[model samples]
Target: MPQETTDEPGVTRPRITPLDIVRTLVLVVALATLGLWGFGSWTMPWNIVIGIGAPVVVLLVWALFLSPRPVLHVHPFLRALVELLIYVGVTLAWWSMGSAWAGIAFAVVAVTSGLLAGRRALT
Candidate 1:
């Protein structure tokens, strides 16, 4: 694995790869889709509020704290935490809508992707 070495001899950063880029794009698209699906599935006033508000709120949050150029300038672990929270929340939202199969599939993908990212960070 390629390591991102620093000026100091032993310190290094996780080397970002093409696969990482692809994974990031996948997550971004998934999050956007989840936001749309979640809000669109709501009832009545919630539908009115969430249908319009959820996408805006989620995208704002993503741009602020989760994106590569986060406005908040958070730590990588913090970024990862936020990502996991959103992913799991979306999974639960699907499950709540009685889409058990979709929920399970999404959960599996999200978890597997997260683990892969974590492993790369550790390496």
Candidate 2:
């Protein structure tokens, strides 16, 4: 499918990049995790250290050297998997969480987002 993008009429639109999807996923994961954790519903000892910490570190280091474009050498699924794992880890951390519904919801959303992004990146 041809990827439609926002344009400035006369000016070409800045094409969306794989990194943009990654960044979008980053925001989604960060917000979702925080919302879950903040609600006092999800608490995993190492989840924060891994999920939150690692992404920040990776993004910071990556930004120091990388420039973004519509074309990305990295695969979208890999990026999504990393994010999904982080959130999954966080969800798993809360062993005491009685309800299983929330985790399922998060998983569904993550996977759906990942697939959409992967397809977009490919095109």
Candidate 3:
């Protein structure tokens, strides 16, 4: 019998690996940040901060897990696009929820995603 070692289909599907999860989480954090600001502007209680901080904490965990250990080589444009989409989607969701300062946080996520774009997709 052979050992059943296998990698997730993230190689092609672009959403099977920890990196993918981290990328998506980046976007979620952007949205959550916006929501947090919105809640704050509305004079909401400090307890509500958790709703926004949750995504950032999750993003950190996923990022630590997603950072390529030895490093993989992915195309620059494709990498940027994937990250951009994730970041935007998450921010947009937050904006839709009527976050007062969500757009500002969205910019931060966009910049972070761009910075992380140097990572290569697993071939």
Candidate 4:
């Protein structure tokens, strides 16, 4: 079983798990992949716009709805939906950039990690 920790005098939180680490790595890779796709697939000015903008936008969305302490308080299911959408968008971006194998591999790992995380969250 996983362990728990006290973050404050009265607040108890679950300890970070292996799944949490995997999920965090997946998010970082997804953001990097988006930036790379933008930089590789566009011209000078447009590349600059997208390469910087894509990750920023994704990061903002994550902060708003998916961060450990999100800006918005939403249902866990809603949070999962948002997270899934980001993953799918990044996977599609990879495929659109002609990295079908990378996209497939990323999707497989992402979905698996997501499902495990979601299961933990739900329980």
RMSD of each: 7.5, 8.4, 11.3, 5.3
Q: Across residues 65-95, which tens digit of lDDT does each residue of candidate 2 receive? A: 2224423445555555555665565455333
TM-score of 2: 0.47
TM-score of each: 0.65, 0.47, 0.37, 0.86
Clashing pairs in 2: none
The reply for model 3, stretches above 4 Å from the true place, is 1-73, 116-123
lDDT of 3 by residue, 1-123 (tens): 889978776565334666456556655656566455445444455436655564565456335443444144355565455556545655655665676376557658566645754544322
The C-alpha lDDT values of all candidates are: 0.72, 0.55, 0.54, 0.91
After superposing candidate 4 on the true structure, give the runs of residues whose Cα lies further than 4 Å from its correct spot. 1-14
Ten-residue segment with the worst summed lDDT in candidate 2?
Answer: 62-71
Native-to-model Cα distance after best TM-score fit, residue 36 in candidate 1, in Å: 4.4
Which tens-of-lDDT digit does each residue in 1-123 have in candidate 4? Answer: 988954678777678888889989998999999999889989999999999999999999999998878999899889889988998999999999999999999999998998887787789
lDDT top scorer: 4
Q: Give the TM-score of candidate 4.
A: 0.86
lDDT of 3 at 66: 34
Q: Which wins on TM-score, candidate 1 or candidate 4?
A: 4
